[model samples]
Target: MSNTSNFRDAFRQAKTQALVGPNVIANALPYVGGGLVLTALGSYGGLGVLRTNPELFLPTFFGAIVLQLILFFVSQNVAEKGNNKVALPLLATYSLLTGYTLSGLIFVALKNQGVGIQGIGLAALGCGVTFIAARQIGSNLSEQDGMALTKTINLGVIALVAVLVVQLLFSAFGVYTPNWLEIAISGLGVFLFVGASVVDFYILPRTYKDDQYLPAALSMYLTYINLFVFILRLLIALNGRD
Candidate 1:
């Protein structure tokens, strides 16, 4: 399961195969839905902690990041080996940690003018729409088209990660992305992930067996999470910074 920058690593682990699991995507949908719910719960819990003991947020947030990364690699290995029993809880925890990490940006979204709950809802809606559209578009793609799009999007995503790393380092030194640059970055993020959402549909069946639904679900979950983040960032950028 992969939906973010981690996807590149996951893809590198195995070469793509012929379509093996027609029902795998369907089977994975429930877990994907469940993961999103858990993520929301985790986000809510994070928000509560932020409100009650703001001082604790930074350390715990960083701790969560480290823990999530560890759990992610471990779970992906276990799941790839078909050890769902161990992997399920690990992935559950990973989702929660991811939501926890998202709290800071979500908090910012909550406070930004013209981009409160409504904007959050719109971001979510945007993912839903993208999913619906991607399913149709990606499913119908010819091999030539699919491969081309996948290559293009993956390259774009790698480039975006590089730019983001640079931006993060700059921010750490008291420099920040300019408003125009912020908008560009965020907008590109949304575009790339929308393309990614489509790529998942095309790639999953080709890559995973029916029993490998856990990884498939993980792939979809991270896509939506990233999509939501970028959409929220785009809205904030467009609406003016807080």
Candidate 2:
């Protein structure tokens, strides 16, 4: 009976740790961009990673996707072995690929013609503040889901899929709409992203255990990326108004 009780306590602690880990990671991810920018600056000055206009962004973009996918699978398999060492390298690799892919986005934002350094600075500041505030609040929040939570999460997933589909269609058709529309869409993306963070917050503790860091990191990374994208779009839209 003592052994059984200890086992249960261990499981509970692991779950709690998982819940906290991703939020910590998400908070740290914004800092990673700063690191990448420094690296880019050192290598190519302002024109390093973000300055080059490539007609073939798809190759690098898809390459990042492929790398992320590979890391996901590798992490999953390694996690099954109940060892975290196997997963850390995969996490590091994903982080590097993510940073590389984001260099293009940073470049595009700076070169948007409508957007200037002030606008970029404002957006970065806004996102950094939001990331810190949300993370702090999330760390203390406790989620005990009932039927309502289930329905909410399900709806969140559906909303996410619909938004993604529409975004893809618009991109495919080259449908350049009003800047307000883009901003509105970005606002919705932010809403969805925050919802996902809440869901992840609840999920990590319930579903994760030893060797779960990689999956947790991946989830937080996705949220970070989505948040960044929408924040950038909002900045661009605001700049367009000026």
Candidate 3:
């Protein structure tokens, strides 16, 4: 009788220790929302500064990029090591820096092309649709499907890097890219980033422990920002010839 009781107690403990998907999602939402709010504020502030002092544009843009990259790697390291205290702040800082960099592009789009509102609206729409799709796709994932998705994500990253490298080469050589090529690249960016967002969302519940919510949220936040930026650029590029 005692042996049976012990076995039951051990099984109960193991069950209690298992990670709960809903609980992880619930814990992550607040951090993701907070990151978005910070990004919005940073973007607004950056736009104002750039508008007031156009001469500072290059410095501000490059500085934000550098800072964001640093914070991103550091945050990833901290998060992977399960240091929530350090990781959360680092992630927040990275988001704000990214917003600042994006604001420079936004300001130019608004002033030169007058497509700011359209870009914002489209970005919001893209985010909403991506979130819904991610949830639907993520919830239905089995272990086998998750493995396949992992491979897809890896391939997606490689493709994204190749695209970026080609764009940089064109820029470095001062080659005049055709309008159609620019539009195509922008469209590709939108698709790639949205796909990344979906993958992140789908894998979050499957991989992360409840205590690892900070990192999970950080991953989603990065995807959200990337998706918005890609959509914004696509919209602006499309409107340029109009």
Candidate 4:
């Protein structure tokens, strides 16, 4: 499970972590931006691999995914404990691996005449817009409303994840999602992550004290990344095959 999932589970309880981290969300923002920059670099590197060594891409991508899973737990634990020195590099590596994993989707987006570079830019811009709106709306959410939305989005995410696993399994057997189904799945994903982005603004501060900004950054990073992925997917789905 990811660090974000752990925090999600933790927040399911009635109690919350004490407000130890004053201005924790603010502290986490710079790292979030830095991590995104690293992710962009990593994606560029992965694109190089895809262009020059296509056969190796799948193996390396899977390897990156497994390593990212391991690193997620380790880095989140260390960061939450306020061990910045140890956690920083680990989290940075984790972010890079995430970007590597993302490259496959990006590759598809890039190759399609419909999606191209412009679609990628739109996907990124969509995430930025979601962050801006989420910050505005989520920061103002009342506790009751926030919790309600969290529970709703959590359930949706669980269902969506299950669906994606099934879809991936089918894909391995040479079955593919129909265009309409892809559109539906991608649309739902975009909605859920946008909602999740909003929830992050509400929950992160309550869950992590200002000292624990790294974990907070991790959670937010995951949110934006997923949002970007789905927005790109939705774009591809709507545009259809080239």
Give me the candidate number with maximum TM-score.
1
* lDDT for each residue of candidate 4 in 1-25, tens digit (9 for 90 to 100): 1534754753653266345555988
Candidate structures ordered by lDDT, highest first? 1, 4, 3, 2
Worst lDDT window (10 residues) for model 3?
1-10
Clashes of 2: 0
As for candidate 3, its clashing pairs are none
Query: Residue 46 of model 4: what lDDT?
Result: 95
Report lDDT (Cα) of residue 46, candidate 3.
93
lDDT of each: 0.86, 0.54, 0.69, 0.85
Instruction: List residue ranges in candidate 3 displaced over 4 A.
Output: 1-22, 112-114
Question: In each prediction, how many residue pairs overlap at the backbone (N, C-alpha, C within less than 3 A)?
Answer: 3, 0, 0, 2
Better of 3 and 4 by lDDT: 4
Tens-place lDDT digits, model 1, residues 1-242: 23554566444533654677778889999999999988888899899889999999999999998898888888878887889999999999998998898888889999997899999999999999999999999888877787788788888888888899899899999998999999999999999999999988887777788999998888888888999999999999999888
> Relative to the unseen true structure, what is the C-alpha lDDT of residue 149 in candidate 3, on a scale of 0 to 100?
66
| lDDT of candidate model 2 versus the reference | 0.54
TM-score-wise, the better of 2 and 4 is 4
TM-score, one value per model: 0.95, 0.65, 0.84, 0.94
Candidate 1 global TM-score = 0.95
Q: Model 2, stretches more than 4 Å misplaced?
A: 1-58, 117-124, 139-154
Q: What residue pairs are clashing in model 1?
A: 1-215, 1-219, 2-219
Candidate 2: worst-modelled 10 consecutive residues by lDDT: 1-10
Local accuracy of candidate 3 as per-residue lDDT tens digits, 112-193 = 4547677687687889888888877866666566556655755665576677678779888997567788778778767766
